[model samples]
Target chain A: MITQQDFEQIQDAIAGKLSADEQQAYNKRLSTDSNFAEDAFLQDKLKNILSDKPFDEFRGTLMRIETEYHYLGLWRTTETSETFSIEDILAMFEPVAHYEQALSHADLRAAGTALLQPQNGSNFLPNDTLTFAWAAALTEPLVLSIENNQEDVVLQDTIETGTVSHNITLPNLPAGRYYFKLTGNNSGMYIGMFFVNKNLLDEL
Target chain B: MVTLQQTQAFMNSKHTLNSNEQEKNTRIIDGFKNNNTRIIGECYAEMYPLIVRYITNNSGDETTAKEIIWECFEVFFKNCTKPDFVLNAKFSSYIHSIANNIWLKRLRDNKKYTYTDITITESSRHDFDDDTDNPYASDIDDYTDQITETIYENDLSHVIRQLLLELTEECKTIFRLKHEEEQSHEEIASLLQISIDMSKSRLYRCSIKMAQAIKNSPYYRELIDGFPFLTNYTNKKRKS
Candidate 1:
């Protein structure tokens, strides 16, 4: 059994955390002694451990960041301000897709809807796009503003799917951040916010 | 994410024993236990990735690798701070060695040992005492030459990354600090609120696991063939 003193001394030397004299002494003794094979083995192992990895395995760690959920949401009724957690709703959506194609194409809004209220209530919808309008409603409200060269002329159309699209025209509007507030005429209210660059639009 | 400086400071601090680091370890042996997360967290902050890399590099799935690594640390930490326990080596090497043993034993137990055409021998002998100043000088040169030749050919790194993804959050943290940050076991122990012995053991087991992982992998085997020191050494001392 190695003595604590010896072990500590050996460790200190190996770590290169030792004093000059101690280090020199360790070097001298190790050079001549075969019995110190254990120490040599330890050093060899340390070298193996510390040796520059010719292969960059550490880079693989970066991939983990993608797996984390950047956004989590609470679903809101399309008709009411009442809020409820969609966790149970999400849990019920089982066998929504194959194990590999887990990421649904739907955005957060769509994913939120699928997670909150599954269509069959039997299958788990993994698609991100499936959440759609209900998901947009669930996210806390955000204000969206569109700056145009002219504020008077507006293009508004309600798609047959009940989805509404608004195109406002403005002349000489400066480029800046904008917020929009969306309210459904029906019981379901949905809000979506995005940034618009008038300068870029003007060029087009 | 435990900084090296933070780990150093923790090594010098006296707050851990006063806290429940020991208490939690005790509970692990008896049943499920949760302790000071931040402290326990330090141990895993960097260790997780190392474990994953080791397993994945060798040839194991991430889930099995993560499970094995976690189990090794859990058992190691549970006994690390026992007043009677003493740390014998760098936590990194210790943890790696233990993990390697565990993985090797598993492979052996499962009868998965196959003669991969590389003949392992116990025939060659060297004269230099391993502890001497020039002990491994020749070996190093040979290993370096082999590695330098194959630097561009091996994809051992890709396999390692695939396995790393399977590790738990705790395991990743531990691996980062130990391997990437190069912190010592004592420092890691205090930062993680685990025993110094536990930290060392984890590192040892992690290394062993990784080595095994690499050895078991066909890609790693092909690469190691070009790595003279690793190949020659194993052929002489660790033949299958």
Candidate 2:
């Protein structure tokens, strides 16, 4: 029977905590006593079993990806002509930027207008052409500005009124959080945020 | 952070046929071995479409395709962890081969689908053989053997996780503190409101209980029987 003291010694030996004299005695006993060696091996295995963080973490990631894919309607029951682009797949794994925190004090929507396309907190690859759309049309020209996380304007454009949607080819920008705001002269302002990730594009 | 145009130009210029292939393969293998999530995610994104296409061609749906691909990844990742493991084929080809085998086996087992009815293309057979080079034939066999061993390991891990769930809440907390949180005995004692000696004793006792549970598990017995070198202690203890 292994006593607590014996178990403690085995743990110490496995951890390399024993003094020089104790280490020599432990080695001698390990070579001579089969039970002691067996106990030591078991303790080592137990330590491994307890500290399997990598396996656990990998498994968690796999499950999370699977669930995200399922939620994204990637799994199909029958053959469909539609396929996901690399950007679409990578966006699913990108961390969400809570851009709402930036607009908490400001009004996000105008009185009758709604921002659509490139949903809030969406991710985009640099230089990709994106269609920005809104529901309501104001008579005055709308000023559109894209700002980086530091609130510095990166791209500025003026959208002619009567058109609810405008196609803008995003300029090459560094990978980080960005917010776009649409302001009308008389109408209130509409704001949304997105992320530019260059890493995935490079991988592609 | 290069401009997008510069990055594209660089990518186009950097594509040397042989070196690029070798570098990409090395990166993928290392990524899987190290459990790099970004690399794995890239692999998933790249291979998922191919697997889905192959499965859909073989009278399988995307749901089955997803299941088989994930299972292949588990086996492949486990094989990558083995010290002697080698990848003789492209990572995508190996994964495709594993997914093909798994899907075919499933089809064969199901009463609705017959082996003859399923189409096995010439290219897929070549991939399944994974015998592009004559010198690496034995390594291909090793891949198969490793897959089998990895399946068993996956089962054993599942069983172990289940056994962990059987541990008492207090035992689980103690384990999390010691192993996951890497807490010292004094810290654990302070958190749990117990003496340092008691904290140490509790951890030791919990480990002993876990060891006993693992030894008594049927999966453990099966693993030991299949791989006798795993433990001589069981046989010696039986005799003594």
Candidate 3:
């Protein structure tokens, strides 16, 4: 079993604190004993880590900071004021939309809404109940509204469960490009569009 | 609505830190490490609205917003102390990613979130950045394992630093002066209003306590038992 002395010896050897004669002896043990060699290698890794001044400095800074917190009694709430609303905390981040993508005119209508059932530009019967998809899983009920090219609301309904996908029936009207908007409980709005197959209706 | 240009400008500004800017960043980082409540509070207050908007805009209430935002703050503070950490962007953007991931994970857990074949918006794409260095594919818990690993692998020195920080006030001061600042026992004693002999002995005891803590750590136990180096090395040797 490796004793404390073995550990010390390994550490010293790795740090080059061992004398030439002592180093030679340490190397001898490494060549002779496999276990000692493995321990020595580990000690070497530890030595490298320990000697990292930048890392150690960072650690020292953290310790001082932690200790400072202890004295300040800031572990809980502020002594001077009442706890504030959490929404106030978000101000620390610079308000920015990092997610922005240029979209085609058709995709622009969808406005980056998650779509599952109706493929964009696909032909659908006017009387069909098309399955709608949204990328976000919202617990609150949402409103699904469909409008024609003239921006007239054709179908508007409330879905109780913001399931991954839901079926929404279309109003039997002239086949044309229809834009859809999905809005959840203060969650914001997402949009997409689908086409009513005028030719398919003619065939029928 | 922060644009990509704004984000690039913020990150780019970090490369040009004047003395005041450097000092301010240091103070903020130092305040967090030390748990200066005022600094932390102000920071929390500032970040709260952003978190609230994100959560509220996604069907969440204030309570849910508070829990996720606070958790993200803890992670953000710890991340700031990472050695040689570069300020690559507005720290808010980084926090934004973490908070968003946590909420997304929460939604998935409650079965409110689902995957679809639709194209992702810029908002979802911005979530690719992670602050915690968490390697997990999904944005959720298993945080206890990570906490242990952080002390062991990612921040062993920092763990020791924390342990030292947790010592009694006298011990903390004496140990910091003695070891970190390399102050002579006489200097420490005079500065802290203690006898030189007392200072020496206190430093000694504090060192022993730290050593004990290290030895008692589960990571050290595994290391001592040859679980990592020894077993692996022996197996490799045997194979060879």
- Best model number under TM-score: 2
- lDDT string for model 3 (A34-125, tens) is 76775555444433444445455444444433333333322234444543222222221111221111113334322234555566555677
Question: Stretches of candidate 3 above 4 Å error?
Answer: A1-204, B1-46, B52-91, B100-170, B179-181, B189-201, B211-240
lDDT of 1 by residue, A1-204 (tens): 334455556556546677777766666555555334333333344343444352122222212211111122212122333222223223322222321132332333321232233221121111212122332332232222321222222223232232222223333322322222233334232223222332222222
- With candidate 2 superimposed using the best TM-score fit, by how many Å does residue B220's alpha carbon deviate from the native? 2.6
Per-residue CA lDDT of model 2 for A1-204, tens digit only, reads 467898889878767788888977777676677666756666665566678777677776677556545554333322433334445545433433564554564445543566667687677888988788767664667788998866779999988867677889899875667788878768767777787873444444
Relative to the real complex, the DockQ score for model 3 comes to 0.02
Q: For candidate 2, lDDT tens digit of each residue in B1-240?
A: 789999887554432224544576789878877776556666776677777777776777888889888888887877777687657555776676677666755665464676688665544334333334432322233356556556555655666667889999989999889877879999999999999999989988887887788778876766655543234443432333
- What TM-score does each of the candidates earn? 0.26, 0.56, 0.29
**Candidate 2 chain B lowest-lDDT run of ten:** B133-142
Superposed Cα deviation of residue A166, candidate 2 (Å):
11
For the second chain of model 1, what is the TM-score against the true structure's chain B? 0.34
Better of 1 and 2 by TM-score: 2
Q: What's the i-RMS of each model?
A: 14.8, 6.0, 9.2
Query: Local error of candidate 2 at A174, Å?
Result: 16
Among incorrect, acceptable, medium and high, the docking class of model 1 is incorrect
Docking class of 2: incorrect
